[model samples]
Target: MSDKKIEAEVRQFTVSADDDGIRLDRWFKRNLPDASFNLVSRWARTGQLRVNGKRATPGDRVETGQIVRVPPAETPPPTAAAKPKVERPTLTEDEIAFVNEIVIHRDPAAIVVNKPPGLATQGGTKTHTHLDGLLDGLADDAGNRPKLVHRLDKDTSGVLLLARSARAASFFSKSFSGRTARKVYWALVIGVPDIKDGYIDLPIAKQPGTGGEKMHVDEEEGLAARTRYRIVERAGNSTAWVELQPLTGRTHQLRVHMAAIGHPIVGDGKYGGQDAFLTGSISRKLHLHARRLRIDHPDGGQIDVTAELPDHFAESMAYLGFDPADGDLPLDEIKFSETAEGKRRAAEAAAKSRRKERKGERRSRGNGSEGGRSNSGGGRSKR
Candidate 1:
């Protein structure tokens, strides 16, 4: 390697067609492999790095011909600035086989899998193996890892969607964010709901003391959450199979809503307490399952799919004499009244989405597939 010192000056570069919509940090990793995340973050915070004369965040997407200015990087001592490179973990043979067995449908644009219960979506603290790690099974021909369009809880097993390419990912994510996608989840609650077919309109907030991924009904200082549930069948008064459709995608929304209605999903001890348990040889695993997903396909059509129940859930249903055949009922769309705040939010979102749509149309006309974009606006949001 040459021992020349880096010049203490600013440098600007234009984004190429292939690199459109990629994160600034990712662009740096590809263009300047030696730049560390810490260095990029520090440079962004100090305004030493910018895009088209504007301050650039590491998460910001650089468009074609956008001028990205980078300050001269200081070369610290090799031993002091040695940053470890993160290598993506590969799936084991068993994991790959498991993925193959669970995959219900796949195409060039998307892969729909019947994710089993007890598997986390993304990796986190005290966790290593996850659905994200095992997604190599659905990688594209170019070895691009599929993108997660939505999330399901670790304890709830059901249909999970993944996009095969960046363009498809953008389209699906925008569809989900824009409320064009519909979801149907099935669960066995402890008690039969008195109001068999009604909506559970309640606000949900992060419980202050749960110390983990737990939520509570807090109409005062919480986000608006709503779910419509219909009782499909009941086994005595102890358990009932209910079909649910969530209007807003909040963390732990379904679990919290059912519990709020005094018929917590069976085996959801995190919120249901003692009532979550049942006697006899019935399984204690969470009974929630994502039964169906309906979304607009990237290829200009609708993709509606259903997932079969997991083994434990199937066995439990058999033990309770709850037939699965009768659970298939056409899903109904639910509507809500627009409050003052809701109207304001709706108007703002509509305007922003329209601008993005126009920008996408212009880009498509100029660059075709290379500039294809969705309402997600070239990149995913922070949260």
Candidate 2:
């Protein structure tokens, strides 16, 4: 047989600091935007793509400074370049107008937008219009589409960052992964916090039965979660304006933590039930707003931005005796991270609680022998 023909040229790329903690598939999407989602997945499963020379799965997380090898995407043969490049999909007129309206700041590396509430960052079921879908409108003449480096809840409005290129995306992703991105959020709570400035250390986990979007505090069966909050203003005893800085990124951490402390975030019906609504002048819209964001830029500078409150949030603030100009609160002083050991200890405590519950169940059972066996200490009867 003749010598085997050559395959696609394999290329190696070193993951930058900003690209940390991203899934392999996401990495491909950021770096090779032209490649189909299925194509990158196929390369991973077939061993054409790899991490550090070893075969890896698509869902595998790639850390900062790691090397990822990608096989050449299927392209036309050598003479293909002679043909003109095909046109890219254009954004709808509405999307173009929307992108233009939300853009607060833009540069070579990133575009910062004041994302409005009720707009989902990424698309989902029944979500036809989303920020990410419309980001294509911001693409340059070269067809380099902007990418979302982070996300915000659908009902939470404020400063949202988008990376204009793969390099910038990596930079911002690393900033979030390394905990260097300082985020401050403002919320009008149902009740006043007794302590003006304090920390809420609670373990949060997914609720037992429901969609994965739900998060609840479970001492034993949860991940470590912590939030630092300061009372910005008090609207008498009924409600208060609070500024919160989350130390850990857990699903619904803020909503659950505030609820656990007996002061649920105003308008958060999912956690506070009927109590979420404040009847009178206060609107029933969730009062959470991502007020400000500060992070390092990819090109060796810093980006600090503040977003104006949404209409509902501003109205609630005014109604609740909060001044929109009270921006002097300290935001970035706290340095906190929940260690792996702490989370492990919390999980152990939950496991211990489960074991004790099982023992109690055994004791409560009608079977005397099972109850005795579970509750009994030493085998022999003590004198």
Candidate 3:
């Protein structure tokens, strides 16, 4: 390892207010502009960042009035010892076959693949095969390594975007951040929404008083979030096919919002009903897919890409008595409530607990544990 050191100062600010309560590493990237998000994540894992002088976890919230202490980075010294070479694994024939079958649309700026359910978009620790790993062999253009610009859940199949070059990747990233890219998702949801078509306008805030692993609707403290949905087909009395467009990007925003309104998407384990994983039901694979994407092409034209429905989605469509080739469906306007009661309850409970703890500490200090006290019943013993 190479030796390097970095010193940082403590700051008084809240991560929740700044990021609408995003993950700690994401918040660090926004605040410490010079620090790489990956490096910040490393620091978090190694206990280099602290909250109120105690080591902090990456998921811990930096609330208002709290002081955050960012410690200096400690880098190990390099040695002259020879390093062992590690071999890269070759792709299996089965993996190659899967990649060869998924290409639906391709262009100079972007490539859209019909991702099958259970295939990961990118690799991580313990991931042996992923879309990126298979790309070098599948690309039609020689010497080009396709890069994924956005991600789909591992279990949710459909359209996945890949940028052919760094320039294209940057352009698409900006478009997504600016809310100019149009992403349409297809899902089979439990029960039809009360309204035919509408926008969900709820503001999304991270769950307060806990680590920032969950999000909830909070009108006062949450960031503005919007999603529009329209019913595509009614699959009997219990389920309906719908199209979704998110106006704001929040992690798992669509799933959470849908569940909040009593219409969770089928097969969604995190937010769906109890029987979500059972076979022979609509709740087996989350039934959600990134079906279409429309964006201003990096090469100066509009590009619209689509992915064909996977086998499961097709089976559900046929079961619902809807033709898979239908071009248009009625659009509905669904709106979400600006405020959610759950978030308010959490915030209030947090405030109350903080006040109680402060009071208890004050009493403890007054009761004398300061320097030294005579525990043995002596007449005013001094240390």
Candidate 4:
């Protein structure tokens, strides 16, 4: 309260270690509680706000020892309404217990959960009940709720990771974007793939009419998406249990790729349609599950964890005479760049580079020839 002054005066603050990887707006909330977000936006827009002498935005992360330049604060006009703070929804006893039961692994930096099928990760229109809304139950003693770093489809069950703090969230987000995190998923496709172990190199784009909720293979206009799958066991041509590792993260990449190859995941009506179902007691739940995750931790070592299958998936495996013990197959000990698709991409890029080099060489030779002719003719090209 004492820092608030009517006279125009600029202020600068050094980012502390605890505020290392948080957003610029978040820093304002923590240090200068009186500074409203509207004021911050105005400062950022006019180039009055800066981070280490460069113009900065609210979303930019601040590191330790960085200088954050702030504009002068002024008393708000009488008409300006105070910004309202959003609070977390209260959870009932059962809801609190349900979230606590899903936690599989907990550390200082991360929390892993065994999310069940039919439970969405975040809420959306017409989706009032989701894991994100119940996160208040998972708050630590200090009331810091973990943040979701990645997402799983509403019907996909398995290991989902959460960051305990903003620093960990930043670190994990980078790991995922950089492709250093490894995720293993298990699914039962209707039919077996002929090539037991291979890559699905397909480009995907949002489908035309589904309002961006659906994805399809679009060779010309799609983003590059790849998945590596290996058939673990076959059930007499009825269904096959496969391990899928996505090399690129795309919306519905696994489901789309599997259906594209004539084998759709069991119970996936969105992509597989009516043929995705099976006769008998098999449950009509999506057969895909995120089996395992391995990623570097923010503090020191790595976090490797595997989730247990839900009741339906487990029963289905037993009915097909497949042992659950064989589900956790060792991840391929080969680098992604060593795959067949990787080699093809590398070759294509190299060829393009060679073409450019050849064109440059030809241009250089033409210029040299012209220069020689001009010199011999006792003339020179003007600069």
Among these predicted structures, which one has the highest lDDT?
A: 4
Residue 133's lDDT within candidate 1 is 83
User: Which sections of candidate 4 miss by over 4 Å?
Assistant: 1-79, 336-363, 379-383
Q: Answer with 2 or 4, whichever has the higher TM-score.
A: 4
Query: Model 3: which ten-residue window has the lowest total lDDT?
Result: 333-342
What RMSD does each model have against the real structure?
A: 14.9, 11.3, 11.4, 8.1
Top of the candidates by TM-score? 4
lDDT digits (tens) for residues 67-106 of candidate 3: 4566555333576563464434677788768777788877
Question: Which candidate do you rate higher for lDDT, 1 or 2?
Answer: 1
Looking at candidate 2, the ten consecutive residues that score lowest on lDDT are: 1-10
What is the lDDT of every predicted structure here? 0.80, 0.77, 0.67, 0.84
Give the range where candidate 1 is weakest over 10 consecutive residues by summed lDDT: 334-343
TM-scores, all candidates, are 0.71, 0.71, 0.63, 0.76
TM-score (C-alpha, index-matched) for candidate 4: 0.76
How accurate locally is residue 97 in candidate 4, as Cα lDDT from 0 to 100? Answer: 100
> Model 3 residue 203 lDDT?
81
lDDT per residue (tens digit) for residues 299-363 in model 2:
98888888898898888777766787885486545442353333545787999999999999887
Q: What stretches of model 1 exceed 4 Å from their correct place?
A: 1-82, 334-383
